[model samples]
Target: MNIKEKYELSSRYETAKKDYEKWGIDVDKALDILKDIKISIHCWQGDDVTGFEANNQELSGGIAATGNYPGKARNAEELRKDLDKALSLIPGKHKVNLHAIYAETDGKFVDRDELKPEHFANWVKWAKENGLGLDFNPTIFSHEKAADNLTLSSPNKEIRDFWIRHAIASRKIGEYFGKELGQTCLTNLWIPDGYKDIPADRLGPRKRLKDSLEEIFSVEIDKKYNLDAVESKVFGIGAESYTVGSSEFYINFVNKNNLVPLLDTGHYHPTEVVSDKLSAMTLFNDKVALHVSRPVRWDSDHVVIFDDELKEIAKEIVRNDSLDKIIIGLDYFDASINRIAAWTIGSRNMIKALLSALLIPNDYLRKLQDDGNFTERLALMEEFKTYPLGDIWNYYCAKNNVPVGEEWIKEVKKYEEEVLNNRK
Candidate 1:
């Protein structure tokens, strides 16, 4: 599939007025700004697969561990009700990923005895009714029980065995989703499968990782469908810090199996300089799909806070005509921040970043390319540094009469203030 088919852009906007007031932007203007660009917005946040409190379906495995809806939702019906609320809020083309709950606890898997096929059907039906496509992650099958803490070097051989098995299982799950969903869905697999320590644990597990990709890539398909595997990294915990090396490693791995690799912007923040992040993307440009979000020291997938430096890297990606290769989604969530806001802000910011990058004059960009300082010059580009991609995005929501309340403004203002003060 082409970049438009693969990325099919999207974001979350809580309300029109808030979007407009914040940036005085609108949908048509946003559309004109992004002319010929393919964009899709959210139907709603999916549940967290890990069972962590308040599951946001941005990624799928975490909610399954808890075996209950983090939203305290009682059944598939209630889940539908909540999702319906989200759908109504947006009222158009939809893009969504499945939650970990559906994989592990929603009564659909053979390994999890509690799953009922009817419940699963109802969930899919609800999504289809609203015109939203499923972003599937199959590892929900592994949540049948809690995972024993496993690292490559953990004392227990069982933990090592579990990781290997889980990797294989995740691929199978993706294949299953492809079959079950038929042409009605799209899948993005962000594997949480990575070593928590150095390579010595089995040293051979990297081989297992390759085997996992092979399984997913080998799937048979008859129609256009998007399959993306996100290379995600966790920060803060040293023991959990092993996965991801050079961009070369990512390209080599995906190229070996003929699978696409997703670049989560935050994953590179704590290590791998920003310029390398772009180079990593360039190496896999044909197979790249950018995952956008802010970085906190060691903490990741933070709220959609735009960084000029990060935008510079992204701008070059866009100006070089790779923007079409990106499907921007929010990699953020918070107990304190309204979940919907996280989606809207992160998505809006990503669109803004792309436009800001595109607004730069071609003459200047060519100079950077010639100077061998393209990345740095892109970073210093004035338009990308100041353009408001969200002005029209914010305005369109208000024109449609979507509510953008004062409190929401207060929260966003606070966020801006905090971000600015930190730079000082």
Candidate 2:
């Protein structure tokens, strides 16, 4: 930004800081904490969920990324380059979440079940050079094996075993990522094994799924190298009647197995929000993994905006002082707009929401509630909403040496013109 813009942002931040000080909130401390918060950006966003598998298959498993937006990364090299640009605009050192299908197999057809850490060596090297960590997921869809809408839960033993092997392979790769990068890699398992129509025996499929997961976890890996998490969804496009891996199922399994339960913001009913579930999970689990996204009516996987739910999710994490215990990651793919802009916008807003939460006077608010001053507490909450949050957010972007506000758009547009358009 220009000098004038920097001066204006600094001046505004000073005024906002003074206002926050009255409420016992430390703006500088909040900024420092915000800098440490890292949100893992999903790699699939750059390629529209189309991984670098040799077959060039379409997305499946009741999930699909709509829109035919141009310039989708066609290979690992292109995807990494796009991610590098996205990371450059986003502040703070973060991690990249990769799917098993994105492994660089060097033109060899290494199926998911046979995936090894060497397949992702290029990604590990790139992440290390870029000062980023890595997370992993096993891809269990868009393949002939998953065409029946069944994977780990399939009655057919062969199909179920295939997915089980893939899940195990994914964990091993995640361990490699953590070992090489010196950061714990969270290996999450999410399968689309369900029925479009109501099933006569739901218990059977769930039992089979449990068995598959049990077998996958039987081979123990060190927790220091890999952390295992399971994600569930209420429903999906094809699996409207039932989803084998429901929230209740995963929650019970995670609790029983001492594994992390992942909560995806877009994986619930329209009326339900993950914000209200954070405190409960924190109470039960030592750590939780979050998949941040925006859901219009269903699991639409829309680009995350700075909405009320987003702010509330951030507030819950900050108020409970669970920043260190929560693993934040973005999980959305919107090919409708400029992909890089989508990444930049969603990531920056998530950071802004956290900053807003950190700026709240949590101690004072809790004390007010404990003293039975509900009226005053409610009034103060409303007043805090009108505070100069935007000014503070602008100041944060400036401090990070990134563009303040809309200025970042110019950089993304320039890249799109100079690079993305030439992909074809």
Candidate 3:
């Protein structure tokens, strides 16, 4: 077996061991190698069988409440329960994506009545008490005028004010979460302040959003708080149509703000820009984290698929050294049937894609390093494009795949022996 096969086999064993541990089943074998698998799977509150079965079992994290879920926690008390449930499912080291507040005047952002320190204190306390990890994503469009919901209004003052307060509050929240949790604060800031009917050069809202972020970073959040600004696409109708979270804007905004950019795959799949999305992310690997979920053209399916199109995008992300930035959480809507199972299936497919990326022959990558040819690298990607990304994993994992495991372990031993002999 080659080096890639060696690592793949070792990874499979390590993940299997971890999976067994969850059910109180221990594997009596060497598992020192899985210590390096840094990938994480995303989970949400309602996810049940589908999401669970599809989960990497080896690596999983708590779910984040998508702002649209009306039944989810909107207050500290509700959040505590949410945190508790999430913590109960995963291992001790997993994390949770916290929806800081529903950003509508009619929602939690305003219901809290001017965003007090205690409201946030409640969240921090809950996380600490439950040992649940927390992340942040603001629902900025919740308060817009009924008619002007996801776009910039004529005055746009209320929206601007909402964001100003939100930015300030988020910064404060980031600092508190970081100091209190020892875990970095991840703020997924989605810009809903855009044009609806006609393009609005209403640069004021954009400027305020950016300035607020910069000011927050300057004034709050320790270096650990990764303020990942997410640009999301909103799906709706006529007067309320919105799509500010596109590659066109995010690439420039992140570069300009000196903050990390987050891309939601579902947001752009409808636009046929998945490849461009990957290209932009590749160039900005140093400043991007992926929100990987399935997108069905016009809607945010949040389903995960190993579709050929997404498969290629996944390859590019892994090839570009950006897998570390990926947070594999399901963006599934709570109202969907078998929602949890959907998340699991999607997550399973997602892990398969990630494994495929990991198994890509290192020699091919090394050749790119040696040649320093950018075009050649892209061509190489095209060359190995047809391989079933995750099926290699299923082949060994679905049954008594022990032979696959032994063959791989031997390969690793051979590599180790070669390296030790060379050193001597």
Candidate 4:
């Protein structure tokens, strides 16, 4: 940024720091903690969830990324380059969440069930070179195998067995990623196995799903290398009437299996919020995984903003002191705008929300509630909102060597002009 902008940001931050000190909130400590919280940014945003798989099939799951924005990454190389630009603008070191469909298979056909660590060798190498960690997911959509909307829970033993092998293969790939990067890779399983209309036999499918999971997890994998998590969804486009992997089903299965239960913010009814569920999950489970997204009326996967729920989610994590125990990851893909901007904006807002949470004097608020001073507590909560959080956020971006404020937008425009626009 220009010299004038730098001076203004610093001046504003100094004033904000003084205001925070009065509330017993240490700005420096908050920044330190924020820097350590590494969010796993999903790679699908760059390519509109269209991975490097050669099939060129349409997205079939209940999920769909709308808009026809130009310059979507056509291959793994372009996707990585776009991600590099996005990460440059976002502050703090973070991890990249990848799907099995994004595997660089050297122009060879590698089905999901037969996938191996070699298929993702390039991804591991790229992540290491970029100094970022990696997380993984099994691609259970946009394939002939999943055309029926029945994967692990399919009544057909052969089809169910295929997905089970795929899940096992995905875990092995996650293990490879963790081993190479010296960090545990979260391997999440989310299958769009549900019926479009009401089915007479709901129990049968869930039972089969349980057996499939049992088979997938039968082979022991070291927790140090790979952490397994199961995600649940209320409904999907085709699976409106019944979803095999419902929240209740996954929660019970995860608890029984001693696996992490992943709660996707967009995977619930419009009235339900994952922020309210965080405390309970953290209390019960040793570690929890999150797929952070903005859901409109349904699981629309809108770009995340600094909305109330985002702040509440961040507050829950910070207040409960469960930052280390929570696995934070972004799960959204908006194709209408500049893909890089989508990534930068969502990631920055998430960090901003976390910073806001960290800047709050949680102990003081809790003490007020405990002392039955509800009026003072409510007033303080409202007053905290007017604090100069932008100043602190700007200082953070500058300190991290990322562009301060709107300056990053200029870089994105330049990239589009020089690079993204060149794609035919």
Model 4: pairs clashing at backbone N, Cα or C within 3 Å: none
Model 2 compared with the native: what TM-score? 0.98
Off by over 4 Å in 2: none
Per-candidate TM-scores read: 0.64, 0.98, 0.62, 0.99
lDDT of 1 by residue, 250-353 (tens): 56776766556666666654755443555556565554555555566644446665676557655666656665555544444443443444455555455555
Q: What is candidate 2's lDDT per residue for 1-424, written digit by digit as tens? A: 6788678889999998999999888899899999988898999899889898887787888887888888989999999999888887887889999999898888878888999999999999998998889999999998999976899999999999989999999999999999999999999999888888888999999999999999998889999989999999999878889999999999999999999999999999999999999999999999999999999889999999999999999999999999998999999999888999999999998998999899889899999999999999999999999999988888888788788788889999899999999988
Q: Kindly list the per-residue Cα lDDT of model 3 for residues 1-424, writing each as its tens digit.
A: 4678667656765665554344243333111111223223343433221121111122111122233322333333543443343333222234556554422222222431155445556666766876545666553433323234432222455645555566567656665676688876666766544444666554554555555555544554565754555554543333234444445555676787666767666555465645456656656555565666666545444566777756666567666665565544445544443332333355445555655555555456567868887687777566556544223453334332222322433533453344322332
Clashing pairs in 2: none
Over 4 Å off, model 4: 2-4
Model 4 Cα shift for residue 336 (angstroms): 0.8
| Root mean square deviation (Cα) for candidate 4 | 0.9
Comparison by TM-score, 1 against 2, better one: 2
Predicted structure 1: lDDT = 0.45
- How far out, in Å, is residue 350 in model 2? 0.6
Evaluate residue 161 in candidate 1 and report its C-alpha lDDT on the 0 to 100 scale. Answer: 47
Candidate closest to the true structure, highest lDDT: 4
Query: Cα deviation of 136 in candidate 3 (Å)?
Result: 0.4
Tell me how many clashing residue pairs each candidate has: 26, 0, 16, 0
> Across residues 2-82, which tens digit of lDDT does each residue of candidate 4 receive?
899889888999999999999888899899989989999999999988898766678888778899888999999999999
